[model samples]
Target: AQSVTQLDSQVPVFEEAPVELRCNYSSSVSVYLFWYVQYPNQGLQLLLKYLSGSTLVESINGFEAEFNKSQTSFHLRKPSVHISDTAEYFCAVTSKTSYDTVIFGPGTSLSVIP
Candidate 1:
């Protein structure tokens, strides 16, 4: 069975500050990595993903993460965040195909303070 683990349950930061939300996973077969964000009362939106080739992946919204196979980790990082960035972020993984459904970790809530 595959599993994803997110180290922090919550992260609180001021606007324009840097932040990192840790993630680690274990799977017997090849998998795709993804990070999704959910705002209040909304569904999850794809943030970034690592399928193959480059170990690093980025979101259009200034967030990035690297897939580290050896360590079984894919940690999300943002150099600076806006108050609008406050949301619940989920780290997920799926077996190699789009048809393969993702399994999510307990989400990490990011609160951006003024």
Candidate 2:
């Protein structure tokens, strides 16, 4: 079984400040990790993913995440945050054998302050 967890449930950052949203996963079997963003009153959108190849993956919106196998973590980071970046972030994990079944973390709400 695979499970995901986010360290902070809420993150508040000043505009143009760097921020990081931590995500950790625990699974006996190999799995894939993904980060999704949900804007207010909107559907969740894929931010980034870590399936194979490089340990790091990035979203087009200036967000990046590194999959650390040793740490069992896939933390998302952004150098500078914009007000438009505020949203709910989810950490999802799925086993390679059971890709259809995805487990999501509690979620982290990011608030960008001006």
Candidate 3:
């Protein structure tokens, strides 16, 4: 099972500064990881995902996430956030290879104080 220590309840950041959201994962041999971000009053959005290969996001609004095995951490980095939008981000993972699989965590709701 993969798990994250979870970031602060609400992360405060400046508009033009870089922001990093850190998440730690358990040393599971095979797993699929995903990031879901939901802005205030909006539906859940897929920020990025790591299933088998290259961890960097190809193209997603200048947002990039990487899964590092050496450091055993997953980080979500953005060059700079231009808006002060409050968001609810969740970290989800599964220990299955197929698309239709059951998730493991109890689910987490993280708030970003932009």
Candidate 4:
């Protein structure tokens, strides 16, 4: 079985500031890592992924995260953010055996203030 947990339910920061959204997971076997961002009433888009190479992965937009095996964690971080970045973020994982379904965390809502 696989499960994901997001440490922070919400994060509020001023525009141009840095932010971090914590995520942790537990799984019985190997899995794929993914971070998806969802805008208002829109579907989620793949931010980044760590399949099986370097421990660190980055999204096209300046967001990055690291996959830690020992700690069993994957936390997202951004050096700077804009109001447009404000949205709901989710950390998800899919097992090698079960690629059909994705397990998602409760999700973290990022609020960027102007």
Candidate 5:
């Protein structure tokens, strides 16, 4: 079985500052990691994922996450954040056996302050 865990429930950052959202997971076998963002009143959007190949993955919008198999962690980071970046972020994990089902973390609410 695989499970995801988000270290923070809420994260507040000033505009134009760097931020990092921590995520950890537990699995006996190899797993695929993902990060998703949800804007207000909108569906969850895929931010980035590490399905295969390189352990590092990035999104078009400047979000990056590295999959550390040894640590069992996939932490998301951004160099600079904007107010529009504020949203709910979720970390998820899935294995080959349970590809249809993705286990998501509690979620971290990111608030950008001006």
Candidate 6:
């Protein structure tokens, strides 16, 4: 089985400041990592993902996450944040054997203050 863990439940940051959301996972087999964001009253949106190829993957929205196999970590980082970035972030993992089944973390609430 695979499980995702987010170290922080809430992160408060000022606008234009850099932030990092820590995520760790444990799995017996190979798995894919993903980060999703949910706006107020909105559905989950795919932020970024690490499936294969490079260990580092980036999103179109200035968010980047590196897949560290040894540490089993895939931490999300943004060089600068905006007030619009405020949302609930989730770290998820899905085993290679079952791509359709995804396990999500408790979720991290990012509060970007202007």
Per-model lDDT:
0.94, 0.94, 0.63, 0.94, 0.95, 0.95
TM-score of each: 0.95, 0.96, 0.75, 0.95, 0.96, 0.97
lDDT of 4 by residue, 24-100 (tens): 99998988989999999999999999899899999889999999999999999999999999999999998878445
Scored by Cα lDDT, where does model 4 land? 0.94
Candidate 3, backbone clash total:
0
| Candidate with maximal lDDT | 6
Least lDDT summed over 10 consecutive residues: which range in candidate 4?
93-102
Question: Least accurate stretch of 10 residues (summed lDDT) in model 3?
Answer: 104-113
**Where does the lowest 10-residue lDDT sum fall in candidate 2?**
93-102
lDDT of 5 at 84: 96
Query: Could you tell me which 10 consecutive residues in candidate 5 have the lowest summed lDDT?
Result: 93-102
> In candidate 5, what are the lDDT values of residues 18-80, reduced to their tens digit?
999999999988888899999999999999999999998999999999999889999999999
Which portions of model 6 show Cα errors greater than 4 Å? none
lDDT by residue for model 1 (39-104), tens: 999999999999899998988889999999999999999999999999999999999855777899
Residue 93 accuracy (lDDT) in model 1: 94
Q: What residue pairs clash in candidate 5, if any at all? A: none
CA deviation > 4 Å runs, candidate 5: 98-100
